[model samples]
Target: MKPLNDVIAACPPSGIRRFFDIAAEMDDVISLGVGEPDFVTPWRIREAGIFALEHGYTTYTSNAGLPELRRLICEDLEKRYGARYAWDTECLITTGVSEGLDLALRVLLNPGDEVIVPEPCYVAYEPCVSFAGGTPVRVATRWEADFAIDPDAVEAAITPRTKAILIGSPANPTGAVQPRAALEGLVRLAERHDLYLISDEIYDRLTYDDTHVCLGAVPGARERTVVLGGFSKAQAMTGWRVGWICAPQAVAELCVRVHQYTMLCAPHVSQIAAVEALKEAEGDVREMVADYDRRRRVFVKGLREIGLECPEPGGAFYAFPSIRASGLDSETFAERLLHEESVAVVPGDVFGPSGEGHIRCSYATALPQLEEALVRIDRFLGSLR
Candidate 1:
């Protein structure tokens, strides 16, 4: 029989999801593989969704989203990140940051366009680039540099075909926040090359030390950067499927056109919830971030005590540690840890080639779960020696 689209066929199952699937069937498994907040949606936010449903407000919103929600998004962006965008012309609420990423790639890339991605990144960027018929040029960011993007390396990778640079600050898996200097350099490069800058700041609010820096806040960057953010991480609304993209007016208009055909709009009820989330949920986000920060300290210190080389993550809830000293490849180490210790983690190579010999452990679980998982990991490492 004739088969699937070759592009679809070429895409492998997500490395992160596959491990979670296995762990789901195992008894007494402790999974640190999923990159989701452990917190519940704020009661007020959940009630807003429920209230919307009870009021029969389930109909589809305008393709761009509810205007009030868009306005709130604009206000939130400016108030939090020092970035200003026109609510009506510069925002499109998406199904999630995942869809925002998709729309950005679709709207900006043409066949043969090249997108520069930093390795050990969120797993989706390369596949999304490939699906968009663009080449993904991955530049490896070393743990030695705390996974910071090196402007020299990025500039070296660019060619005439290069169309954009995709950045994830408070990056997934690594939890590495790009320093202000690095962001400034990247913005300068984008200007020099006249390339688009897609900054995924989904984990913006999860920072432990420094305040979140929006690339759009840099000089001349507001016009060139497409900022992607959502309710998933900050507000514990992962299942709500609500996110938004803020871009230049022209690019946002184009993205909305594509979004109209692809997802119509983010779910109406979720949009309502998200508006409430932005306004009334700050305390919930603050509390969750504080909890995760404590977990981050405990987890990193525990790993270091076990001889694992873990850099202190600045944001997000993950710890990317080198397991090469255990004399096992990342996949082998992960498999044995799950089977023997019943502690599940994603192999670092799932992010990119540069991530081999490492593993990603999310500290988004409760303290008890994280502490137990660490004990199991220590035992597994000791057994290796």
Candidate 2:
């Protein structure tokens, strides 16, 4: 038998899932590993899907998704972030941000093209670029720098092979939000180098301290940027798998061409539900955001009190705390914490080498769970010392 495609085979499985699997086999395990909101999809949004199903709307949507949904998405973007795009040709509903990321890379990358990615990012970014036949050139972002991308470093890494810069804000694992100034610098670099910007904005509405600065809304960025967002993090609709891509008309057309052959279309019921989410769920989203903000403050303070140095997470529901003082690397620390304390966290190194001394703990769980997890973590650290 022939071997599988080397690239696909070589791609590492999600690092976040290893601890998840371990936790599943044990009782009384406190998991802060998965990067998903604990909240269920809002009642109104779920009802929309149920209504569609009862109405016999189980068919596939158009390749670009329902027209009304696309228009509403465009309006949401413009109203929330000041970004503008056409619903007909410039917006495409995808299975999730995962699919949108893949489509963006496939459309833009040729074999051996290079994509600049900042380290300590989401687990999928590098592998997605590699699977798309592009080289993922990583630039390091330090814990000391709050994991923000340094545009000068990105500019220095560019060569003739460099084709794009991929970025996720309100980022997973790190929970770092790139400020407008940092993004402005990146946009200028992209323009000067004639490179594309793939902006992952899935957690746009999950920020706690500061407003999420949409990369596409930055001056001179909208034309060259592919903005990927979805109903998962904000609307708690992860299982719905409905996300969208907004890009320039030419790039978007090619994405649709590829998507039609591969995905055909996003689920019809999910599209209907997502429309309701965008339309009628703002209050639900606000309430969830407020709850997460409370959890974030309590969780970060608890981590510091436990002797782990946690930089405050400005956005997203994760806290990447440095565990170097524990005298164990990220993988070893996470494993021991799970077994000894029954508290589960993801090893930061799985994100990149730059994340070596840290572990990612998501604060999306209920406050009582977070508080209990912190207590267990403190005891675990005491035993280690």
| lDDT measured at residue 378 in model 1 versus the true structure, 0 to 100 | 91
Question: lDDT for each of the candidates?
Answer: 0.93, 0.94
For each candidate in turn, the TM-score is: 0.98, 0.99
| Candidate 1, run of 10 with poorest lDDT | 209-218
For model 1, how does the per-residue alpha-carbon lDDT over 291-377 read when each residue is reduced to its tens digit? 999999999999999899998999999999999899999999999999999999999999999899899999999889988998999
Query: In candidate 2, how many clashes are counted?
Result: 0
List, residue by residue over 235-278, the lDDT tens digit for candidate 2: 99999999999999999999999999999999999999999999
Instruction: List candidate 2 segments past 4 Å from native.
Output: none
